[model samples]
Target: MCSLAADLATLFVAFALANLLVIGKFVGEPAKPHGLVMFAMIAPVYALLAIQAGVYGIRSLAAVRETILRACWAFAQAVMLMLVIVYFGKIAEQLSRLTFVVGVGFSLCGLILLRPVMARLIPRMIGEMPAIAVVIVDSVPFTAPTGTVLLDARVLGIDPVRHDAEMAARLASAVGHAERVIVACPSERINDWSIALKSLEARGEILVPELMRFAPAKLDEYDHHPTLVVAGGPLQYRDRIIKRLFDVLVAGIATLLLSPVLLLTALAVKLTSPGPILFRQQRLGRDARLFSIYKFRTMRSDMTDHAAAQLTQRSDPRVTRVGAFLRRTSIDELPQILNVLKGDMSIVGPRPHAPAARAADKLYWEVDDRYWERHCIKPGITGLAQVRGHRGATNAHQDLIDRLQSDLEYVTNWSVWRDLRIVFATLRVLVHDKAY
Candidate 1:
């Protein structure tokens, strides 16, 4: 929260300075008040861009270079968004260009200037973190990380020779005193120790891999320490909040902006089809929960088998004339923006599958044990698979595998920037031949 406050303060100060230099009393002209409205309009853009670029990422631990880099990256992205909006909306004609550049420049400089002060004071402000207790068994070949006081695994009640009751007592004692626990054991032994460590309540308990099955696609920081997620099962609480915010903001904006097109498409579906205009189907969402996803109906209502489980193929007889055009243009998917708004789905995630979905006549879950892992996050209306042209019918085993691979890859390595890029890429796929 302090970090957010600091960034917001920095932003306003930059804006003020820019206004002073570019338009106001700095050159002896009277200060104008109209900047307030402009600030309101552009503030959130900077905030979101800053969040996406790791501005609120672990500042206490970051060096001066890292602090500057992250801030600059965020400001650059914010500027790009500002540029896009400016060009399309002709904001340049209404606002001073020098003010824009100076504000951004001041923001970057202000952020860099503050880092040293923050780095000096943060430790004192937060107080020294209770040194984490790293418990590494002898098999893992121990090296202690900086700032953490070591805890003896054997003293903490682990036995390489035999597992026993006294170990639990030691583990309890150790956890009681420690701020957190890092259990570094061999890959095979992590499960047993993880269960044990979890029983003892700690602020955080992490299992570091000596050697693990699959490499993590990304490494992120947690509590000023490096952390790795095997499945990337759930996002960091902050990232999750950001992702949800991104979904709601983007989904809401898109719906409002595309309302005319949405209405026209609905009319097209209604006029060309013999049934309902919006198609709603039950599909597995986050955590495998069934949710009703909305789309503009592109096929005749009578096609049960294909509608229920089978993927549509080229020249599929079920497709209505309007449906074909909607499918081709990908406008049929516009209604699912509601799904995104309603929290049943994300704007970017694994593509949801029908409850009875099949690939090569086998249930998708049956095809890969890792398939269910993809449900760690909400299914998306437009996903990495769809953007990668892994759309259309699923026939052979490899097609399912290919799409699943993309889905899993997306889940394993996801960030807001990555999601935005994928969502943008989905535009190309919508009109590409693969979407059919």
Candidate 2:
């Protein structure tokens, strides 16, 4: 909060100095309101970019060099964005270009000067620093650095195999108030531990030998021991923010634009079916967390499978007459827009599956170990697999593999543009032959 306040104050000062002295006095011209408009546009952009760059984070308190660099980087990007907006809006003639350049220069200088002072002052004012390091011992031999909170996974009843709300809560409680959480477990449990830690509000690492066959995003040494960063919840913090913003914006607009369709679909399901209008089923979401997914009811109430233990089949008798058309047109999945707005899912990501969902009579995770890694990000209503026509029944082992391959591919190489592309591509496959 202190950093944010100081940075805002600096920007205001820079704007005042540039407009009052540089433009009004030196240029001998009436100061136009256009400069103020530009300032308004740039301030929020700077804040968002600054947050993404970690300029107002804990690192700013400990590393002065990084703090200045990140602040400058954010400021530079904000100015560039403002220029783009001005250019596209064709309002460049409304104000003097010199004012924009001078204001940006002053703000850049102010940020560089302000960060070092805040770095030294914040700690003294906040009293004792909070715990920033934690180590979890999960039946593995390890040593922790000095002054770290250490907890035993067994004692806490934390089992990664039981990936449910109760276990997630236990893990979160054990890792409270720590900025970094490291888990030491047997090599066989590395993937399990990674999935378990993905939902926590902290950085997670696993202690493993350097020779382990794991492809980690980063590897750091702790007390001369190797620690692999296996779970960086949402990959990058900036990407998480960007993806979430995209989800909310698209989902919110979609709901507003498609309200009539949603209402008609709800009415159709209610009037045609004997049960409820919407069906809620438990499915695995991001970080292997379980969430109830919403969808228009497409099966007989007595035949509805909340656990998704039975996969839908072609010409299934359990499906109602109205349900078959809904399924065939992919209208049954429209209720999941609420799930996206509720933050349980994304607009584009690996599709979530039920805990007991299986292929070739084998559970998905049992068929392929890499399946667990797909939970690193939130599941989506439509995804790479869906658009690629890898939908419907997973009757064969290779069926699961094909979808899994597309899902992992999406997870490994994600971008906002790719998500947009997938969303557009989805429009072409809504009435696909394999939808049922």
Whole-structure CA lDDT of model 2: 0.81
Clashes of 2: 0
Q: Identify the runs in model 1 with alpha carbons over 4 angstroms from their true place.
A: 1-31, 34-234, 304-307
Q: Which RMSD does model 1 reach against the true structure?
A: 11.1
Candidate 1 lDDT, tens digit per residue, 1-436?
4665687787778877787887774332333333443455566776776665666644344556775687677767766876787789865776666777777778778877877777677678988644444444435665665665666676555652332223434455554434345655666765555445433323334555422444453254443434443332356535766998889889989988999999888888888768888888887666555678888888888883533766778888988888888888889888999899889899998888886667778776557545655665788988888877787777877788999899878876889999899878876667866555
Tell me the spans in candidate 2 whose CA falls farther than 4 Å from its real position: 1-36, 39-52, 56-65, 80-91, 96-134, 140-143, 159-181, 186-204, 208-219, 228-234
Model 1: lowest-lDDT 10 consecutive positions: 160-169
lDDT of 2 by residue, 389-408 (tens): 89999999899999999988
Each candidate's TM vs. the true structure?
0.54, 0.75
Candidate 1 TM-score, C-alpha based: 0.54
